[model samples]
Target: MDRLKALAFTTSLLALVYFFTQTKFTLSSIQWPTSLFGGKQQPDFSMYKSLSTLSVQEFPLDPAQSRRTVIIGDIHGMNNSLSSLLDVLDYHPGSDVLIHVGDIIAKGPHEGSMTVLSYMASHNITGIRGNHDQKVIEWRGWLDWLHRFPDGRKWLTALERRWDEAAAGGADPGVWASKQMKRHRSPWWRTIPKDWKIFTEHYKIARAMSDAEYRYLLSLPLVLHIPHAHTFVVHAGLLSSDPRYKPRDPRQPLARVPTVFGSAKSKHGSDVPKLRRAQELALLSDIEQNTDPWVKLNMRGVLKNHDVTRGKDGRPWSDIWNRDMSRCGGFEHDLSFDDAHTTPNKHKMLPCHPSTVVYGHAASRGLDIKRWTVGLDAGCVYGRKLSGLVLGRHKHNDLKKHQSPTPTDIPFGDNFTGHVVDTECQLE
Candidate 1:
């Protein structure tokens, strides 16, 4: 009986060895069953990837175009407020170019994000990606990757099931996770934290998104340049220029100015002069290349040392930008021999053009309107006001006067005038 049992065990061991050797099974080789997850084929991961930095989109400056340019601030999923603000602007679809200043979706109502996204997509509106939008994109990307593997799908399903169970029991998922960690005493439990529920909404939003919506989010750039308006639209703020590199001659084309005179070709451009169009192209190229992607999305201050901070540690970047824009160009200032010696970097102290930057991430400041920078975020998600900067060719008299008390008329391009219009938001 013992010999027979040993034979059977040896046979089973041989069978197992044969199965592994013949099949060559591996985690990578396992195919996720499509039927398990809506029967949809795996999507091309690259199709939904977001650009890190230097993604720029420029609109042609048509002199004859009478369309108004409306730059709106952070919506933060306050779709009702957004709609009311547009109504207040008397927005005309064919005659107005709508540009959002990021944070269009997230944090307000449950359906507000998708509603705003759908509206923007249908209207052909464009804008930069906000920090919140980035988080949603990341979650979607993670979910997409996980859905490509059977085990990953199972894990996500289990998490969802657990979340549902916790919700049904009227228990906080974070608290429940803490208890599980204590009971299990396993390293895997550590992966689930007490604050995991904070990201649950983002995960839910990502999962509920359609392909078109996901694609739209992925298409958003870090910086949007409006050449004719002499404006840049970003989520947060931008530095004037890199302090490490000596300033260039504002009088000459950016491409012709060398980093260090006679050292080598300019990092910005070739030694040869570029045409007006080429120069325009080089402007954003230089700025986007020098600035980090994160800085463009969250910068609030620029330290004295030229370092940027997302916190309130230094001077507001807008103040620095306005300072740079207001300075006299090197050519405008004449220096004597003694003065030149005293200010060795005098020639490098050229001023930037009075270009405008419309940004929206700093809601705490609320409706910041500077000479060269406009901050339109008015904390709409916090039951404050939704703000917008409307630029139109109509004369001040011809433009429709909005009833909103927040409207402030301001000068725009050579032929355009702008107004800061806002409406009260419903408390979430």
Candidate 2:
């Protein structure tokens, strides 16, 4: 019995050594789920939420100061179009403040996207977190882990240089070598190096990215509040039930701690595979069946229910936000946009006060402009036009004084426009 025990231990140790030798790295070298959206990495929803909500910024240094806030819609890496739009608006750098409605990267050329970000950073442009932007940020974390070690950095730098040379049509067929990966059929997956396929396709872009650029994306806020304009800007719509609604930090996680009910009762079956599938579906149904009006789904939820929840329809949160201003957690009276000297009420007590929200996550419906909300994702990366909402200083004052007693009927504050992009591009 003692001899048998020693043999088992030896066998286990040999197997472990063989595994590491075959993989060309130790188990510690493998950053599990290093790919975007958890390729092989374990999903830690809490860590994801914390990293995602790490940044939130307020608009207007002083509400009383003269300001012209220009809020642009999703620019899915269309730098040329963004430049054209800014020129059209004749953007005044010092006096006019620029804000994006999220989705700052993905879809366009990698280099172009970097340029756009550099421009925004230099110009002090800020935005809320869009789904695409969120995905990229998540990808950034994995890339950071991959490149953290010296050996990893050396491997990545060599790979990135090869890719860049191949992309430029150099004699070396660096990009050609990755063709074997096409059998997998994921464009993202194919971009990863052969030995390093454990990581994400975003590695190519991430390796090329400067540290400052990554930091800029890390600093994105989930929501921006404009006190003078009485507006809240987010990449997606707001859920009043969320604790973050009141403070609205972009760097904070938006999802609540999922309440776990007792496991659903299941009938025992001889077919183990069938039983497992049934269990998965049952768990999914429980999450989907949650009746809360403000339960916001993260990327994982959407991907899981992409097929299951199809064809079902419900009213958008903005459309149903017609309750009294006080009930909606809004001010009793309109704040003066013209007065930069005016301060917000410190002792004001109120329930959920609904304000106008400007967002851009819904691209399928295109630009959805309503009385209380503005959806600006025009699917530009899908070959549609890149849109922008210009909120002039004069319009700010005009809307502030003209607040309708009926909150639902409040006028849309910004002037919307789109720049046409003829070529169709894939959505990230």
Candidate 3:
């Protein structure tokens, strides 16, 4: 009888404690996380119920002479490619118009290249936002996307410990990290001499930008209709491929396309592979009907297989929670304008708008230097090669300014495209 009575008393006391504590806890607690979005590098997409169709679109059409307009593809972060391309085009700054296809960030030799390239764009270049550039914007929460990394956890704790001190002291963690990386400065980051390190480390991304500038970059239309050549210029090509584009709504913000559920509009989103996937599928009928003995397989052969490759490692990392583990995680889209399997004949490119399309998201290995996009994106950051395409009256093999080879090329470690181009060095 005594034990039972004690037990009942304790239970009653606990109930009273819970009832009384509820209000106090509610009143005293800190703010609930209303901003569900993640940090600059990651964000939460669940906040938006549906994705807005508002992906990028094309700029106004250009009307002029019968001359051709050069369109380049993804640059990633390789400013060297851009430089060499300009040199090739002999771009007269104001006279010639160059269209950068997309992807202004990620992968390449230096972060600073973006800064330099941005400066160049303000002066002469115009561009489209590639999947990587979109990723950069989306990663920063410009567009709604699912969150993976926990909030404010982009940096390791060690760096976080020194963040406030660095920020308060007007020190940058990335610079400090690079300084501390003194000894470990991988062969890649140290290719350029130390004298130029400060300006060069982030030279590409550090050239001061204005709101008008970034907005200008963002404002650039994905498609550039050239009435001059009767051609349409685009970054990764339209997903629908029919040219029947639906404009994204202006009022509401757009949402991220979930990797698993697929997109209601199309399986592919803004990513390069998705755009290509749609094209491959659309072209299948043409490939299948190739009755000619010379023609190879049609679009089916190219579109049938899914691109398993993505991310820096060239592996799929789109949505881990969604895609099946068994699916091949290494599907890579072809970089060159033309591929062998597509046409069913010799290696040939799609019938590009004869006027011109220039792009460079892809990198390639070189025999001598870090050849920018041998096939495409020739390991630039790894000190391989910086790549770009110069479209100055594209008259075939003649347009390319051929230069003889030197040492810098190899399969292994050191022998990289150590060749440097100093654009920012100001002379007294």
Give the top-scoring candidate (lDDT): 1
Q: Estimate the overall C-alpha local distance difference test score of candidate 1.
A: 0.66
lDDT of 2 at 188: 40
Instruction: Quote the RMSD, in angstroms, for model 3.
Output: 16.5
lDDT (tens digit, per residue) of candidate 3 on 45-105: 1111111111122221222222333444445565665566556544454444555555555
Lowest summed lDDT across 10 adjacent residues in model 3 is found at: 293-302
Give, for candidate 1, the lowest lDDT window spanning 10 residues. Answer: 48-57
User: Over the stretch 1-428, how does candidate 2's per-residue lDDT look in tens digits?
Assistant: 99999999999999999987978766556443345444554233112221121121334433245555567888867887777656655566777667887777766777666777777666557776666565566566656665554655665566556566665765334335556246334334432434443323344445456777767666776656554344667676653322223322221111111112434322233332333333222222333322221222112112222221211244454453322222332222222222324535422323122346677767777767765677777777777756666543433222323321111122452322212111223433
| Candidate 3 or 1, higher TM-score | 1
Model 1, residue 185: C-alpha shift (Å): 9.7
Lowest-scoring 10 consecutive residues by lDDT in candidate 2? 250-259
* Clash counts for the predictions, in order: 0, 19, 51
TM-score of each: 0.74, 0.53, 0.40
Clashing pairs in 1: none
Tens-place lDDT per residue, model 1, 1-428, is: 99999999999999999888768766337564453435674444323222222212224234245666678999988888888888877777776667888888888886988899888766657788888887777778767766766665765677678777787878765677667556646332332323334235676688888878887888888877655556778889876655444445333333143233335432233332222223334455566522466787889887777677888678888886676666534223422222445666665444223467889999888989888789999999999999988765433443346554546887654345577878999975
lDDT of model 3, residue 428 = 11
After superposition, which runs of candidate 2 have C-alpha atoms over 4 Å from their true positions? 1-66, 150-202, 227-229, 241-314, 322-352, 395-428
Clashes of 3: 51
